[model samples]
Target chain A: MTVARAVTCPSCGGSIEIRAAGYTVTLACRHCGSVLDVAHEDVRLITAYKRASANFAIELGSRGTLLDIEWEAIGALERRSPGAIWQEYLLFNPYAGYRWLVLADGEWQFGTLLLDRPEGSLSSVKWRGQTYTLDDSSEIETTIVLGEFYWRVARGDSVQCKTFARGSSYLSSEASGTEVTWTQLVPIDRRDVEGPFVVRQRYKPRPDLRAIREGYSTAPGMDENDLPMMFLVALGALFIIGILQNLLSGPSQCVSNRFDVVVGAADTTHKIGTIDVKRPWQFVTIKADTDKFDNRWVDLDYSLVDRRTQQSIDAYGIVEYYAGTDSDGPWTEGSHHGETLFARVPRGSYDVYVDAGSHGWPSDPRPDTLDPKNPWSAPSTVSVWLAACTGGYSWGMFWTFAVLLFGVPCLILWWRHQD
Target chain B: MSKRLILFSLWSLFLIAISGIATWYAWSPFADDERPTSSAFRGPTHK
Candidate 1:
C-alpha cells in the first residue's frame, strides 16, 4: 500500500506533492527550489538550490512502463562532477521498489539497487557470471533536486562514487562514510521508454567517455572472432574446388612440333607447324630452348593466328644462361629454356610464327686478347616448341577475392576497437 | 527473433553473397586471361 500527501513549502508556500508519503525523508520545493528535511513532524530547511537550466527531457510525475512494470517518475536530481553533469529520475512502483533512470547526453541507463553487496576488490568485481573492471572513481555532488526523496539529501551533498562495467552493463557503488550502496545499470534505448506516457523533449547526444566506453563494449552484429573463422572455412572450400578442377582437367598435346631459327642476326620470322584445336577454353603453351654459350641470352616473339577469324595473339619467350666466378664462389642466374602460356583460345585452325634474336659476350672480355673485328660476339640457335592443353585453373584470382571478403570487416572492427 | 540474432543473420548473408560472387568470377567460363605481349629479354632471366 502507498499514500500521497501535499506539503506546503515554508519559504514560498508552493504545493509539493509527496507520492511516497511515509518513506520520503526529504522534499524539495518546486517553486522556491529549497531543500527541505521532512524526516520528523517539523520540516527543516537544509539548503537553497539554484537551478542552472530547466530543459529536462522527462518531466516529474510522468508515468511510464519499464521492464514490464508500471512506474511513475516521483523524484529528480541533477548531479555534477568537474565538467560533466547528469540527471537521475527516481521511479516508484507500489509492488516494486525504487529504480533510477539516468539521462546523460540523451543516453538513458536503467539501474536497480542491489540488496546484497557484491564481494570483490575495487579493481574488479563479479556479478551473475560476468566480470566487470573498474572504470573510474570520482566525488559527485548533488546540484539540484525536485519532488521528493527517501533520504535526507541536501544541496552540496557529495558522495564517493566508483563504477565498474562489462559490455553494456555497469555496476556503480556510492559510499557515504562507511555505508556503501551498489546499483547495477544497463543501457536502455531512449525510444523504448518514450511515447505518449513520456514528456516530449528534444535530445541531442554529445560525446562523452561513458557513452564511448559503453559503445565500444557492446558492438553490434557478429562476434569479432567469428568472421575470420568463417573466412578460413570458405577459403578452404575454395582451395578444394581449385584442386579438384586441376585434377579433373585433361591436358592433351595438340601440336608437338620443333623448329630452329638463326640468332645474332637480323630479326627473322619462321613458320612453325599448326594444330587444329577442337575445344574452347584450352591453353596454348609456347616453349623456347636455345643453344647458347655462357653469358648469352635469346629472345623470341611468337604469334598464334586463327585461320577462321584471322585473330592473331602475340606472346614472347626468353632463354638465357649466365655464369660467373666471384670471390665467394661460382654462380649462375638465368636458365637455358623458358615457356609462355595463353589461355581460353577458341576452337580453330591456327598458324604459329616465331621471330628469334640472340646476344652474347665472352665471360671475361679483354680487348687485347680477343679479335677486334668480332668483339667477342657469338651467335646462337633457338628451338621453338608449341603445345595445347585443357583444364587449367587460376588460383591467384580466387585468393584475391577471398582476401577482400575477409579483410574489410576485420579492418573496420580493428579500427573501432582502437577507438 | 532477438536483435543480436537478426544482426548476425544479416552479416552472414552479406558474407555469403560476397563469397558467391567471388567464386563465380574465379571459376566462370566467360573469364578471359590477359593477352600475352612481346617483351625484350633481360639478362639473367629464369623461367
Candidate 2:
C-alpha cells in the first residue's frame, strides 16, 4: 500500500482538513469541487496517487507490448508502456494484508473486493514466506441476484478447469433444450478457504517466467489421460447440466441456502468496514461496483462509533463477495465480467470510515448482471429442453460426428497412401 | 438414439424398479385379516 496523503481540500480549493486515525476515507469540498482521499493510516501528505501511477504504468506496458513480461511491479509496468499509465492503491489492513495495483485503462473504475481475514494474517504460520502474484486474465463476474464474484484458475483450458470457490455461487436458468451446448451452477462457499490467509498467485521473477503469447491453448486432441478425463467430462457435462437445468430452470425448488460471512475487526486507517444492507431485495441477489464512486469524490474522512446503536439495527455494513458465474449460459457474460461485492447489513458499528468524496445516495442499485432488464436470470432454459429430448449430449454428439462422421470416413474414402 | 433416449431408458429402468416394489406391497400374500380377498369383495355371503 502507498503512503496516504492527508492535505487541505483543494476544491472550493479551500482548506477543509481531515485527520482521523483509522481506515482511509474520501472527503469532498463543497466549494471549487476538489476531491481527495485520505490515507489516515499512513498520514504522509504525499502528492503521488497510486491509481494515477498505475494508469501511467499500464499505458507503458501496453505501448511496449509487454505481454511476455512477468506481470509484476508498479514502476516496472510504468516503464514498459509508451502511452499513459494508470495506477491505484486501494484499501489495506494488517490481517487482510494490503493491495497495491497498476491497471492499463480502468479510466477511474475498479473494485473493492469486500472480503476479510483473521488476526496476524501476514504473520500466520502458513504465510511466513509464501509467494503470490495477481491472477490477471482471470475472469471476474457479477449478476443481479448474484454479484461480487470470481473463478479461481482451475485447469485453464480443459473443461471443468475453473477453480470454483467463494460464496459468489450461481445456478443456471438457460440453455434448456435439445439444441443447447452449455450450463452452469451456483458455486458453493468453500468452507475450506477458512484460514486468515491471503489469496495470491505463486510469484516468480519477471526475468525468469515465460512471456504470455497465446491467449489460450488449442486442444491437443485427447491424450490417454485427457480422453478418459474429457469423456468423463462430456458425460458429467451432460448429466450435471441435466441436474442444474432442473434446479434454476427445470422443476426443483431449492430452499434459501446458507453461506459464510467473514467480518474481521479493524486496527489500521485503511481498514474501515461495517455491517449494513445497502440494497434490500427479496429472493433476488445484488452486486455493487465501487470503482467510479471512488473517482467522483474529492476528499475522505473517518469517524468512530462509540459502539452505539443507531436506527435500532446494527450500525454496520456486512459485505459479501457475490459469486455470479454463468456456468450454464451460452457464455458466463456479465457475472464474470468484473469484480462485485454485496452487503446488506444494518447500521451498528465500532468504526465507520468512508471516502465521502463521492457523495449521494448510490445511483439506484444498478447491479452487474447479464441483461440490465432481466438481471436475475437463472441457468439456460434452452439447454434444459435440449437434454430432455436429445439422445446423446450436445458436444458428445458433435464430436462423434466431427471425427467419426467426417475424419474416419474421409480416410476410408481416400484409402490409398502415396507410398 | 440421442443421449436423452439413453437417459430415458435409465429412468424407465428406475421406474420399473419402483413399480415392482409397489406391486409387491399390493399383491404379495399376507396374514389372514390383512389380506383383501374374494370373500371380502362379496361382503360376506349368507349361509
> Model 2 misses residue A254 by how many Å?
30
lDDT of 2 at B4: 35
Top of the candidates by TM-score: 1
- Estimate, for each residue in A1-419, the C-alpha lDDT of model 1 and write its tens digit: 76998776644445688888899999887876778877766676667522322545677778998889988988777898876899888899989989999988778899999987777887998877778899989999986666677776655678999999898889999999998999999998877777524655555445599977778767654344355454555565555545544443334445555666444456677777685655544556565655555776666677778888889877676667788777878888877677666555666778877677665534323324444587665434555454433334444544654565555556656766654
Evaluate model 2 with DockQ and give the value. 0.02
- Across A90-166, the per-residue lDDT of candidate 2 in tens digits comes to 32333443223323232222223323211122222111233222111122221101001122211111121111112
TM-score of each: 0.37, 0.16
Best DockQ goes to which candidate? 1
Candidate 2 lDDT over residue span B1-47, tens digit each: 44433553454344344333322222112111121211111111111
| TM-score, prediction 1 | 0.37
- CAPRI class of candidate 2: incorrect
Q: How far out, in Å, is residue A143 in model 2?
A: 26
Evaluated on chain A only, model 2 obtains a TM-score of 0.15
